[model samples]
Target: MTDIPSSLEDVAEACGTRAALALLAHFEGIDLYFPHNPRPDHPILQALGPEDGPAVCHYMAGETVTIPNRSPAKRRARILALHEQGLSTAAIARKMHQTQRWVREVIRRAGEDDQGDLFG
Candidate 1:
């Protein structure tokens, strides 16, 4: 079971059929690597049933599943690791799928964490 965001699940669970249906529609054609029922042909009426249908949109989402560097600490560590591997700024940008500016910022901040103060 993938780590689905509790907020998304909670809201979908409580917001009734209209909301559930909308969420279902939003996830249309999405591929999920989780335990979900992807029976779109079952119609919206079945989604209104007393089951876990409303919450899970059959698409994987959350801090764990999609985003590799979810936290500031993890992001910094990843940046430092890739930098140590001698990857260029542009390569790191491509690997991290982040802007070159953001990658530079992470590398700078992470360097500061490790070296205390390079300028001092």
Candidate 2:
């Protein structure tokens, strides 16, 4: 019998019930490609010594290839604007939508009242 490489496959193979639950929690209602802004300070990325971080591969509307950060609030806001236009969640879901959960979240965030301004 041959021993497996511990580094690559060990973490995945050792993902027991707790790990599975954690994975579900981490990914639930989140887009892997377009994660929420301000990632939770990834230690690994920091440890990589900061050479502009990992490059993401993305395909844009014009079929152009681009690498973008996980969270681009400008683009997200554009999608939110559409949601605020009385468009159905499904409609918004079809357009800029990556996931239904993400669409709903955008709508919810857009609908929030400007309470912050009142405090100021």
Candidate 3:
């Protein structure tokens, strides 16, 4: 078996093709090529830190899949604004047309403090 190369260019060179063509095929097409070296480095991956490395999944037999982490709490707070509009749990539930349980949960979460609020 051929060893995986440490760099894209090296891989392309080993495959007897131009690096750009290899990149285009790997990036634009359905097939994915993992490095033989096992721990190849890319500029974007380097920037994200090892713990935040991108995950790869396959859907179709040869397709690539990518999933990112959920947004931080501060970003999710935008959705909480709807609860702060002084609507009753039942009314909020009706306005959002969500289940009462969901509406209550949102209100509870919105009012929670360090000690946690009782008026959820």
Candidate 4:
């Protein structure tokens, strides 16, 4: 679960994985402004609560940050898991915020034999 995107590496290193993931989940694909002096009502604070909020503030005070919405490896794993669970490509696409073609492609790619694995 600590497998955070590289963009959030500094935050994850500074604050820990839970905090970084929380930030990612809440603020992915959006530019978020973290105030130097975060008020009690700041969204970061509200989302992360007392334990992690100040840690993030201490790390990146007065910064505007955008967490990436997609982690390629994570997305692939999710797609495969959904596929294994008997979800249709269209349903998986809708659920994962991806196009059906993309879902199908991931599914197809996952089933391909890995050339490198033969040596192992």
Clash number by candidate, in order = 0, 0, 1, 0
TM-score of each: 0.42, 0.35, 0.27, 0.56
Tens-digit lDDT track of model 3 for 1-120: 132233334333443333324333334312344322224375223433343223221111233323121233532353366656666667655544345686676557666653555697
Q: List the residue pairs that clash in candidate 2.
A: none
Total residue pair clashes for candidate 2: 0
The superposed Cα distance between candidate 2 and the true structure at residue 9, in angstroms, equals 26
Which candidate would rank higher by TM-score, 1 or 3? 1
Candidate No. with top TM-score: 4
What are the root-mean-square deviations of the candidates from the true structure over C-alphas?
Answer: 11.0, 15.3, 15.3, 7.3
Q: What's the candidate order when arranged by decreasing TM-score?
A: 4, 1, 2, 3
Worst 10 residues of 3 by lDDT: 52-61
Task: Please give the distance, in angstroms, between residue 70's alpha carbon in candidate 4 and its true position after superposition.
Answer: 2.0
lDDT per residue (tens digit) for residues 16-119 in model 1:
44543443344332232333454544433243443444344343223222312225566567877999999998998776657788889888876676775658
Give one digit per residue, the lDDT tens place, for model 4 in 1-120: 447888888888888989998998777655778888898988899999998998898789878887777667887899899999999999988777677998989888877844357657
Residue-level lDDT of model 2, residues 33-55, one tens digit each, is 32223244652223222332121
Model 2 segments more than 4 A misplaced: 1-71, 116-120
Best by lDDT: 4
